[model samples]
Target: MCAAGLAWEPLLRLCLSASLVGCQNSKSFEPPS
Candidate 1:
């Protein structure tokens, strides 16, 4: 459905950005350095 696809576009973007940030944070994480 076009409407459902449109509605999910922003949600998908948000999820992608969130996961990207999480990935970056995890990659360079130095817990006690």
Candidate 2:
């Protein structure tokens, strides 16, 4: 369980970072009203 938690933690962080970056890119690319 400890080893699994360690492995999953970094993956979860990477996924969160990726989603955050994607959200920032989409917001930046959106056209102004």
Candidate 3:
């Protein structure tokens, strides 16, 4: 259980960071009106 918790922590953080970066990139790449 301890080992699983340790591994899961970084995976969760990576997913969160990736989602945030994707959102920022999408906003930046929008076409101008």
Off by over 4 Å in 2: 1-3
Report the error of model 3 at residue 12, Å: 0.4
Residue lDDT tens for model 2, 1-33: 999988998999999999999999999999998
CA shift of 2, model 3, Å = 3.1
> In model 3, where do residues sit more than 4 Å from their true spots?
none
Clashing pairs in 1: none
What tens-digit string does per-residue lDDT give for candidate 3 at 1-33? 999989998999999999999999999999997
Summing lDDT over every window of 10 consecutive residues in candidate 2, give the lowest-scoring window. 1-10
Candidate 3 at 33: error in angstroms?
1.9
Which portions of model 1 show Cα errors greater than 4 Å? 1-4, 30-33
Candidate 1: RMSD to truth: 2.5
**How far in Å is the alpha carbon of 12 misplaced in model 2?**
0.1
Q: Tell me the whole-model lDDT of each prediction, alpha carbons only.
A: 0.92, 0.97, 0.97
- Model 1 agreement with the true structure over 1-33: per-residue lDDT tens digits: 999989898999999999999999998895866
Task: Tell me each candidate's TM-score.
Answer: 0.63, 0.79, 0.80
